[model samples]
Target: MAAAERRASPRRVRTALVALLAAFAVLLTGVSAEAQQRPRTVLEMLFGGGQQAAPERPAVRKPVVRKKKVRATRPARQKKQRTQAARPKPSGQQSAAAAVAAPASKNENAKTVLVAGDFLAASLADGLSNLYADNEMIVIEARTDGSSGLVREDHYDWTEKLGPILDEAKPAVLVMMLGSNDRQPMTVGSRSLASRSEEWVRNYEERIGEITEATKSRGVPLVWVGMPPFKFDRMSEDMVFLNDLYRKGASSVSGEYVDIWDGFVDADGAFVYSGPGVNGQTTQLRNSDGITMTNAGEDKLAFFAERAINRLLGTTLAATGALILGPDQLPTIQLPPIGNAANALQAAPVSIDDPSLDGPDMLLGTGSAGGFSLEPSPRERLVINGGGTGGTEGRADNFAWSEKSAAVTPSGPPIVSRGSLNLQSVRESGGLKPPEEMPTILDAIIEDWSRENEAARPE
Candidate 1:
């Protein structure tokens, strides 16, 4: 029995040890779980004393894919085919070229208009060219030296060269726009004369005469275009002086002078950059420099010259650029012969003073029908003779106090006099009763007060 007891005790001791080990294992597992959940301190981590928690991995989002929009593109082969189809055909190209060259070719036989002078004349020629571009009957011949002037004979002698130019061009009209560059000194032989001096003026006038003589000798009409006002006040003043000279020179040779001053000036006569254009709309006419003109300005500058040319040439240019010849050049029309000229009625000429123009030989009141009456007409007697229109016996105008007896008809009732039936007699006979008199203000007020009293007395 003792040995069995001893063996049972050993088994009991082993069970107790196994239970303690299980409890210790459970506690260690709980501590490890807590350590994992709680974050470690800096000291604990540095000392490596406590178990450090592993960092939780961040949630990874799925990548979102977008669909790409596809475009319909033509193939290179189709694009090339379309481009080739768009190309102009050979016939079309030829027609366009012909159309472009038509104006230049048509002007080959056009009458030349010789434009001669300095830089302004060159610009004038350009303007005139544009003006007559569509008119095939006229051609502008620019014989201008941009740097040439009457003062600078050494640079270009216009007087010496103008004669040859006129001969060469054989211009229908000579358009001269000079003196823009003539403000400089003039060289008369060995002396350099100041501009606008007596000697310079004489020399300038002589040069002008030379140009005019060339045109006069050639029998070409002259049209001298005056310079426009510049931005510079001094320059504009100089232009005015030059224009006066131009006017006299042109008039000396029976040339026409075109005054373009009012065209480029404001209401106050100052220079302007923008103004009423050819079409009358406000547009920029002068360039920024104010010495030169814009495209529109050039066209307007030509407008004055155009009128002179039209008058000198005796030709009217239509809006469509057609040239209408003068009356002398018009075709004569012959009328066809009548079927019977001998049977045509012939009217004799009548004199206005014969007094038979209105089919009356004598006045209506005159007794004679064939001869003129020596007696005056009633109107003439009233106006010239101070006569009165004697009133008729039965008329309303008769003011005689004596009452006339009614005229008796042979088979009818007695005729009543018109004067007895006048408005005064009718009123006396009570034919038209007079209007009743209106109540006075006092009576109206009294009547209103009586009505008020009656109302107050109570109905």
Candidate 2:
């Protein structure tokens, strides 16, 4: 009988065991099949029809065709298998070459700087290096002050001099402060100097036009700091004329015209040192000098240059630096051992733990008084027991003075109620409301103070 049972449909029992095991495994996981949120595979999500193995197409039923939803796949992100046929495969060399040839964008702060001038330019270049050393900017300034790089003359090798600086620096701004020693007559290559100042002006215009062309081609904005009148004797006339020529040239360029000349020039525009002509700051606002400027003169000129730089850059140069010598580093300026001005420099830190701090500038107080010993201004305050009559836990509150009160003290007896006391003439102002013959608590306090004062008096 056992053998016959074994042969009787063992496949049925095996099928039942698989179903029971599958159900038991699902149950042990502690989530019902309906409660589980199994994420569909990408292909199943898009194409659908992935349920219960493929159902056989029955001959008795009509054919079912399901349209697939089109998904927007990024062409650049096609899988490797798709890439195998969808696009041309490039060699490693080709990818790198393409990357190298791509156009790149530049930001302002990342651009280089081309500074052109004499030794002053060199110092500026150095200062800038130290100034922007921590920043990201390149600077180039010539060390030579022997010749001015004016439009033309013996030292007309600007392309050799300034050209290389511009090329290497690849500057977005051309900072030029020139004509300090350009007394040699202006010329066009090998041509003669302009006859009259008017012709000289026209010829100067043409030469400047060339310089502007060179600058514009490089996509650099020119910032021309024009010459200040020289501050010496002898060749003052030639120097003054040269300055005017510089002014005209500066105006000709599309760049900003930094009128540093005015910072040094006299009202008449001639060079002088004293009297009505010298305008070198200390020299008064009267005259222009051959060369040099006072500290004030230099400051004004520097300010002019700073403004032009700001305008060209479309914002402040964005200097982020500590002063070379901060007040903290230097001896705190020894204010005169006495002066009201001493108050101007700093504000002493103060915290208001003692509320009486808001009292009269100069005050008299007993050991029991909580208000300050002195105050700059008389301030009114409310006190429940601070008047010495209220509860022991007196509250001091800032309050406005009552207008009706006739008398007041700078700091008064603890104010028990809302009322005004004249900051001045308190004894006379706060006299008792006279009665026929009775006395009040105010009377008692007064009597006590009087007795104390009498006892303290000399025997």
Candidate 3:
């Protein structure tokens, strides 16, 4: 019974100790949590803390008030001033704008060069404009449709439009470049004709003739720029054919035809993407598509047409800014009247081989000239007179036979020559000794037999 009671007492004490530990842990947790909730004061941080601390008061709240919106009396003026101050200076922009606008400004009597047809014509106009940008008397007016061509008259008929454009623009010159987009089948009244067919070519040529006639009737100078070779072989072939037609049409109307084929082709007459440009530098002339031209190509195209335009307009006008004088206006050049025919200086006809033809009475080394006697040179003596020193006796070149006997005396030295040394002379003079004769086959055999006999005879 005592053991049971002892055990129960220990258990009871253990229970009481556990309860005290739990209660102490709860109290510590509560104090730590409360300390965390409230911020440390300056005094607490500087010194130490106690259980009875001062409580934290609630933050004061301010009253909410609304302010009325104030409107400016001169808002527009203020805004304008603000905008003016904020705006950036357009110095560079203004200069760039002026540069662009400067090219467009021209004299009131500037001659208009009307460029008509397709996109190629438009590019041509751009090039011409750039070329004549400095010349105030020239202007390039482009009336082109990018997709228009002679084949599709319904879309844009150059035949009908050219007359009106000529009258309206009153152009000094009419430049046309088309047929690039005309490779497709062309439509006739009710029947569609295949591209490049005999019938189609006839019809196409007729349209070209019509445009040519219109320009001729209007009294405006016409310039038809032929198409350049394309990357495609078939397209290039068609262009060649079309260029021929253009040439014929232009010639019929007395229009100038500018052939730009050689410019865009290689040595073998194939299309080239890159070629010698206007300045003769190798550059990319055609675009990647090969159908369209790059800026350099456009300039090159203009270069060909520029010549024809200059010729028609009179080169003096383009080159020196001088007026083209007509036949009547040209100053007559009256050459001085020739003196009496008898007193006139005349030249006599001389033979081609005559040495006197060079202004001298005789050859250079022939004889005296102007009181100076010139001796004949060695070359002149040999070639002209066949005169030179004869070969020495006993020399290789000396072919003359000697009358002396063939037998030579052993005591006397052989004859010595000046040009070359002979073998006999060399030996006789003691300068060289005669070589010992080599043993013949019979002699060698006999010697060998004699040696064998001697050995056999007991040596």
For 1-459, candidate 1 gives per-residue lDDT tens digits of 999999899899999999999999999999988887788889997888677556899999999999898986523211111123344668635443422222333356678888988877877887788777666677788998888888998899999999998888899999998777887888777888998999889889898999899899989999999999999999999999989988999999899999999999999999999999888999988888888777778778888799998888766862235666557856674434433322223566777787666686766788523433455655666799997545557766566555554553245543456555566567589786779999999999999999999989955
What tens digits encode model 2's per-residue C-alpha lDDT throughout 3-74? 887887688799899999999997856553333445557787678733324367777966889989898642
lDDT of 1 at 238: 93
When 2 and 3 are scored with TM-score, the better candidate is 3
Model 3, global lDDT:
0.79
Candidate 3 local lDDT, 151-215, one digit each (tens): 98889888888898888999998999998998899888899999989899999999988999999
lDDT of 2: 0.52
> What is candidate 2's CA lDDT for residue 82?
18
- Model 1: which residue pairs collide? none
| Error in Å for residue 89 of model 3 | 25
RMSD of each: 25.1, 34.3, 20.7
Better of 1 and 2 by TM-score: 1
Cα deviation of 364, candidate 1, in Å:
47
**Each candidate's lDDT (Cα)?**
0.79, 0.52, 0.79
